[model samples]
Target: MTGPGNPHGGDAGEKSAPAPKKGKRELWKLIPGFAISAFFLWRTIKSIHYDDLRSLHVVQPVWIGVMIAFLLGSYTLRIYRWWFMLRRSGAAGFGVCSRVLLTSFAANNVLPFRIGDFLRVFTYAGDLNASSSTILSTVILERLLDIFTLLAFLVALLLGAAHALPPVVVRGHELNVLHFAEPVLVLCAVGLILLLFGAPLLQRVVESVVRRLPAGARTEKLQRWALLLFDAVLKLSFAGRVLLLVSSIAIWLCEGMIFVSLSRMLAIAVLPRGPWLAVALSNLGFLIPSSPGAIGVYESFCKAAMTSQGAAPGISGIYGILVHVVVFFSVTIAGGVAFLAHRMARGAASRPLRADLADLPVEMPADLPPGISS
Candidate 1:
């Protein structure tokens, strides 16, 4: 097998050595996120005393059932929304969608760097009979919709219940939440408006930018992918867009109910609007990009929101810990079970699947959204 190109090795080009440097580089990138999580965890722990452990008692055990109910409701709505978004793509059935969605979030809970998102898009895209671009477009849209809804909830809080809540104090200074949230809210609103109304313009701009890139297989592939993002949104009718927004609102409200239920379960005297505020702030904290499951970042944000509204520091810390545990473990365990079942079923059928984008075509298909061919 020794030839001119492989004079010193057997199948030298066919089986190249793995790039250890690339693996090391990826590991190195995760160091900062872990450090950030550690720092916040330490800060959160130091603020809580041994007495905080007492707050773990469930005063009204019935609320425990309520919390679980809302948790299930939120995930159910989320799975349906994902399916609805990909309906035109001929996505899989409700059961398939649920398993994939839960497995993805479970991956996010256990793995760092939000790997679950890419996992969902790459691994299940083929099973769903949709392109990677379409799946990714829906994922990005989901995040945007969540952000918009959360911000809107925050604004509603300020308008409807700000007077009922205590001022948020940071470092002995009264903090104005609205002052900061309003600008971001405005930006998100404007972005959504533009995305929905000016999709064609966005598509054109993407084309113009793609045209400027050096002509290559990679560049052309990227062009189709970028175009597909806006194409999915553009394809939605006015009624469909409204339905999506309404559904997004329902999903977050269900999550908000979880916080409310937890507060009641523990008998923690949160303010009238405390649960909603915590929901808005804590989920928004996810934007900070901490370690898997948001770890210390989630607790810190949740505790901060509760404490600002006059909840005891010990109870606030406990509340944060309880909420994190419920969310982190439930999804991770359910997803783990679902993934194992899926694998077993596939193995029984003797079907092998590769969860990567390499098998996809470089060129857009004729069935792609109408403007993608242009």
Candidate 2:
């Protein structure tokens, strides 16, 4: 994670640093992100009881190793999941997918504004010569899938466990955050279901509009892109859909192990309701926009969850920071390695910036717009 000249431990000449304007643009997008992170981070920090921070030393060393293993496993599955989506988009090969995914992950964790996401589109669009629209669609789909899965986890942990949230009394009134989450989850669940089920209808509506509109390149292209996204959304077969579900569940399981183990590592007793609730809460925090790698939002939600479970503020504070560091550094290092591997394999005669899509059978639809097939 050094400077751009050798981010992945490359030769100093591999690439120069990003230009000044580029850096500024990245920073500019992050203004809101950092502001949000700072607010939440300050809130969590103010709550910490410094005296109890000593509790961190008692965390089991063994769980630390377990947490690492789970994180690795989770990342592996994440690569596979992306590979899976790319294949559906007429791209294959796990090697390429892993490089883009890990490198993008490193970028997101290190840089600002979630710019890493565009790396997925760039790499695949260049290498596979597939529609960028399609690749971007899958990316959005992947996120929605993750969100839905996390929501499921939240719902399950809420219903299946007692003391899911610690009660708080404010001027003799009782409040628990979990109560708020329940309705939100229910509404979100309904919305997601509708989105999935309504894709075809939405697709038809867009297509109809596309047919009627007087064609201009930009407008027509945008409409077609929308059609393509809806098409991708509609096209996940039952098996592919199942795979997404299983992979999402597995990834979070790995994350939950990390969360629970790290809490143990910090020697905080999170039981009964356990780490699932903590995991759920922290992930919910991530759904909100924040600084790179969700720095403040993540810790705030985690500390909130732990404190509600009666963990000391000192324990929660240290646990949050340490866990974030573990993940942030681990993935960044792995991404660097992946970048190096990609460079080594490709060497000087790397693949073209754009390549033919001969691997998958693709046909222009007959009912498509005038310019596409004509």
* Best-fitting candidate, scored by TM-score: 1
User: For each candidate, what is the lDDT?
Assistant: 0.76, 0.69
| Candidate 1 residue runs with Cα over 4 Å from true position | 1-15, 161-175, 201-226, 348-374
Off by over 4 Å in 2: 1-29, 47-51, 161-163, 166-180, 191-198, 201-228, 344-374
Error of 1 at 82 (Å): 0.5
Could you give candidate 1's per-residue lDDT for residues 1-374 as a string of tens digits? Answer: 11122222347554255335544665787888888888877767777887778546778999889999999999999999898888877878888888989999998888755667867876677777776667877887888889889988888887765443456798999867677767877887887777767778877887888889898877877776666667678768878888888899999999999999989888888786878888888888889867888888888878877887788876787788788898889889999999889989878663443323223222233233432424
lDDT (10s digit) by residue, model 2, range 97-208: 7777888888778765454665555444666445666677677677877888788788777666445776678899888656766886787777566556667676677678
Cα RMSD (angstroms) for every candidate in the order listed: 6.1, 8.2
lDDT, candidate 2, at 232: 59
Per-candidate TM vs. native? 0.83, 0.75
Model 1, poorest ten-residue lDDT window?
A: 1-10
